[model samples]
Target: MKALYQYIKVIIQAFSSLLNGLLLTLKYFLTPGKSIITEQYPENRTTSIRIPERFAGELVLPHNENNEHKCTACTLCQLSCPNGSIEIFSKTIETEDGKKKKILDRWVYHLDMCTFCGQCVDACPSDAIQMKNNFELSAFDRNTLTRQLNRPDSRLEESNKQQKNTLAS
Candidate 1:
């Protein structure tokens, strides 16, 4: 009789679980529109979707109209990158006062290898790097993934230039 009772209890529990699952399905079926949490992706591409500010999309080096940037080529960002995504090439130049100093030549960023961990941005002491909101980073060739962060004609900021000049003098 105890074995029979146990069998009955197991049956009852199975039915209860089935009923709970059915009730959840019915709840969604009854109000399908209200229960939808997913967006129709490609169809809604024309519509603008809001992305949060904190979203880590892509790294960008902000440049002003004067073609100036704040990166001092300290290589902190490159050092902080775990995947070796950042490569900074600097050139030593002679100042107006005949003093030699290192200046940033190119800042190579490998987007394909980047994990979007934001370590490089956090490690940048000069606040030269930041994450931009642009998420559309598709490319046909992998070579396009590797980009130069600094503009070809960009130079250090005027304050940095002045400081370097002072140090040279």
Candidate 2:
């Protein structure tokens, strides 16, 4: 009789759980549009979605019309990066006064390995690097993921040039 009671109790609990699940399903089914959580991506890409200002997506170096940047090749951003995504290559150039100064040759950023922790941006003392709002970073080739942040013809700002000149003197 005890075994029969336990069996009956188990059957009742199973039926209770099933009824609870069915009630939840019915509640969602009867709701107007509240239960619909699927987002129509790509189709609604242009109109529906809005990217927030605080969203950190890709790293970019801003340059002015003069093709000047603030990066001094201090390597602080590269050092602070946990994933070693930033690689800076610098070249020493002899000034008119015969003073050798380090200049940024290439600022390689590996987007594939970047974790988007914003450490590089935070560590940049010159405020040369920053995260952009563009999140569409899909690529076909892995080599395409690696990009040079600095433009080929970009140079140091006039302020930095003056500072270097003063130091050299």
Candidate 3:
């Protein structure tokens, strides 16, 4: 008898909640200012919802004179890379200060492999790495899209670094 009474009570509560929901839904339907907030996909993608300021973005490399990239191949970025996207080749050299220092041999930054976690930027002690807002990174062929920018003798490569340096300076 007690279980039957509890079951009846639950049924009544459930119906009551259902009716209340329907009433509220109907009230919204009948309200003067009520309007649909749904956006049309693709076409309405231009509309903005506020993104936080500290959002991680695409990577940016600092540059120096002679259009060389500013990174000394310190490998701090490589160490901090969560996805192992940045591969560096560095050589030991004697600087003007008469001490052994690591000079950057080559910076192989794989654009396709990056997760854009911004850990590299944060770990870079020389301010060599930064993040930019470039988000459109689609490609037809995956292999064709994995870019190793700043090849040794590429004009576009040097010019790109130089442009960044000029802007920074």
- Model 1 worst lDDT run, 10 consecutive residues: 160-169
What is the full ranking by lDDT, best candidate first? 2, 1, 3
lDDT of each: 0.90, 0.90, 0.69
The list of candidate 2 runs beyond 4 A from truth reads 1-26, 34-36, 162-169
TM-score of 3: 0.56
List TM-scores for all candidates, in order.
0.79, 0.79, 0.56
Cα distance off (Å), candidate 3, residue 23: 9.4
Over 4 Å off in model 1, which ranges? 1-26, 46-48, 162-169
Model 1, range 1-169, lDDT digits (tens) per residue? 9999999999999999999999988888888887566777667855746788999999999998999998888899999999999999999999799978799999999999999999999998778899998788989999999999999989999887766567557
Ten contiguous residues minimizing lDDT sum, candidate 2: 160-169
Give the range where candidate 3 is weakest over 10 consecutive residues by summed lDDT: 153-162
Per lDDT, the best of the predicted structures is: 2
lDDT of candidate 3 at residue 132, scale 0 to 100: 76
Q: How does residue 160 of candidate 2 score in lDDT?
A: 70
* lDDT by residue for model 3 (33-86), tens: 667545464565567443456666667675554565656465889998888888
